[model samples]
Target: MLRIHFSSGDLARTRIAEEPDPLWETVLSLQQLREKSREPVLDGWRRRRCARGGRALRTLSPLMPSRGYFPDFLTPAEGSGGLESGIDAVLSTPRRQLCGELELLADHNPLPSEVRRLAEGETGALRRLGRALRDYHASVLEPGWRDIASRIEGDRRHRTETQCRLGTEEMLRSFAPLMGWQSPVLCADYPVERDVHLQGRGLLLVPSYFCRRTPVALLDETLWPVLVYPARPLCSDTPAAPSARLAPLLGHTRAAVLQALQTPRTTSELARCTGVSVSSASEHATVLRRAGLVASTRQRHHVRHTLTQLGDHLLTGVQLGRIPPPSASRHHGRA
Candidate 1:
């Protein structure tokens, strides 16, 4: 069990990440790949990645064991831009901290001499490690990035909606079955029992598509506290059949608008994809937004639309042919 103690201020400041942290995804995904775990979702990804076979895997495998720690410098703090920026942060770590962390890792798991040198602040080795990280991302993560991003975005939207409707306490409570929440304490079902006191630094909740089993947090409590939990599974256990009832209600143009939001898109891009005028696309988006199926936000000059969790659920129901007709009233035979 991993217990995270919180204070009133901590509760007030706790928040969820708005977007996926690329570094966290990379490290966690690599861990998943190494373990060769039989997670259904990762089956295809693992097969494809193994087929490619490269030097990046060779370099990374030794440092990241199938289990145990992999050094915190690899992931950096949240808001460190994207993958490249995060890698930059890793490469730029001060020699003393790097040496200490690497020594600690070596105590538990053997490290390649080159990796040890890099940890000791060797400039050449740092560059090599940087290349390895980039190559790993290119070969492993870039291809399926769209699907990954969409799933993460959907998760964030769901959590945001939960927080708004049920309050922060309820939202925290909902992290259960994975982590039990009891007022000032949240307990995670970790392999090892541990305790983490927030000390009023608060906590950042990061939803990860690749994270499996127990939620993960940094071992060094002095750094910023974060809890990376598995995102809600996007794929159903059984494939969903198409919905017959949703199409006519939304009509063709509006339906097109809703479908185009599977990934975020600007009004113009939505119009282009649907073969409708921008004004028509905007109007359709407005209607969908009003119906709580889509959300539109202005990014500079362009308005981008993304499906809310309700929208995704509605679409899933439609795909499974499970959504009832809007006119189908529950009280029809009753009061």
Candidate 2:
């Protein structure tokens, strides 16, 4: 059920092996402190449960301190046995070299210009750029501390989006050949209203790089091999059975626009909603309108949007009978 398809470098591997994981130590210490603090409250049943769970619970992985260093989703749940085994496997795999390279990049302390220039045109280059941004903000940008808190929030958002895009693209490119997939491809479907039998058939090709913890595979029936050739190839395979769980969002401008309009607001309102310039909103709005979720009416020089019947129906289906009457239609898939 688990297959790792990425490589890591030597230096990152060494760092992983030698790194003094302070955060892991802190976690264990905190847990011990809590245990001592709660000793008086532990009854016989509670003590039994804690003792059982604590036997396997060993340590935590240190929080990734560098921007380029993402948690390995292939890694199993952390504990004494699993953590040690995972680390051993990672060190032995081709991924060791890739991990080493990641750590080296994290520790290199490159000049901004050099980092930017080197990473330019490389696959997942935006992630490398993000690392530079993080380092710059931490070392250089932090000194100009005007409205520091808000600035951090804004920077974080920009950093996350860029990093995700970069990572997703990189993953697709790397695995594309192995899976016969393509790069910069758009895999889309009409977001259908949910129906009976708890079935939905929309397929999403998530970038394995962005997959946290473990890769989630939804295609196991009919399309067993799921051949994805380069240059946006189409599958003649019939769609698989659907679970009630929501499908993953496609990483496109249309999805972003629809997401912005979840509040039953107008097109102009969404422009203000995202603080993006008005022109960008219009461009994105056109795509969403074509998707059949949002409809616009001209009001003087501006256009306002309300959910179409299909949109409203989709909202109900997505909510699965749990929507409150007042805000039900208004709350599309915003979050």
Candidate 3:
């Protein structure tokens, strides 16, 4: 169990990361590759990654063992700047901290020869590691970045709605069944028992598309505390073709409304994009909302409409051509 102690100040400052942190995604994805368990969502990705495997696999394997510590420098706290920026951060890690973190890894498992050289601050090793990281991203993550970004954006929309409707405490409580939120403490299911004192630095809650089962947190307490948890699955196991299923049934206008809602948008904005009147767009949104495929919440003056989980699943199935026509058993429900 990992018990996170949150002072009142910490709670006030806690916020969700606005975008996916690429370095964290790389680290977690490496861990995913090391494990033999297969998830349906990763099937296509795994196949494509394995097919293109080469220096990325060979070079990164040593740094990420099947189990045990991976140097913290590999995933810097300043990763929001994107992949190249993150690689630069790794290359520029302070020598003492780099050696200390590497020593921690060495304590639990034998360091790969190249990694050992890296720990010694060898310039050549740093360049090679940077290359490996860049290659890994280009081969593994870049191809599907659009889908990944859409999914993350959808998740942020849902979370923002939750915060607007129920406040921060309830939003925190919604993270996962394994995570418990009590006054001043957020307890998480973890492999080992540990306590993290926030000390008013607060916590950054980052939602990840690849993270599975238990949430992840930084091992070193001195760094900015971050808790990475699994976001909702972006789509169903099978991909469906959208034009075939959705366009015919919903018509172009309604179909456009559903498609535009992968991210939140107000009716007027939806109207502008779909070239329909505001009233027409609102009617379409109303129908979608009544069908439980769209959710609309009034935020002060503007009402933002976002796709519900069912909406996303339906759209994904439609786009991929996997969803079947409505049946007695296929009732739409709230996300």
Best by lDDT: 3
Q: Candidate 2 on 240-334: residue-level lDDT in tens?
A: 21111122443333444454455455555555434344687687677667878679888887788766766555644545244345565675644
127-245: candidate 1 lDDT, tens digit per residue: 98888888877777777777677778877887778888887777775554355466667765577878899988889999887888778998888889989899875543324222223
The TM-scores of all predictions, comma-separated, are 0.67, 0.23, 0.67
Off by over 4 Å in 1: 37-53, 78-80, 235-335
- Candidate 1 total steric clashes: 4
| lDDT comparing candidate 2 with the true structure | 0.34
Measured by C-alpha RMSD in angstroms, how accurate is candidate 2? 20.2
Which scores greater on TM-score, model 2 or model 3?
A: 3
Deviation from native of the Cα of residue 122 in model 3, angstroms: 1.0
Please give the CA lDDT of all the candidate structures: 0.75, 0.34, 0.76
Candidate 3 residue-wise lDDT, 188-288, digit = tens: 65778889999999888888877777788889899999898877654554343353358789875587678767757786666644445679879999999
Q: Candidate 2, which ten residues in sequence have the lowest lDDT sum?
A: 10-19
What TM-score should be assigned to candidate 3? 0.67
Q: Which stretches of candidate 3 lie over 4 Å from their true place?
A: 37-52, 235-335
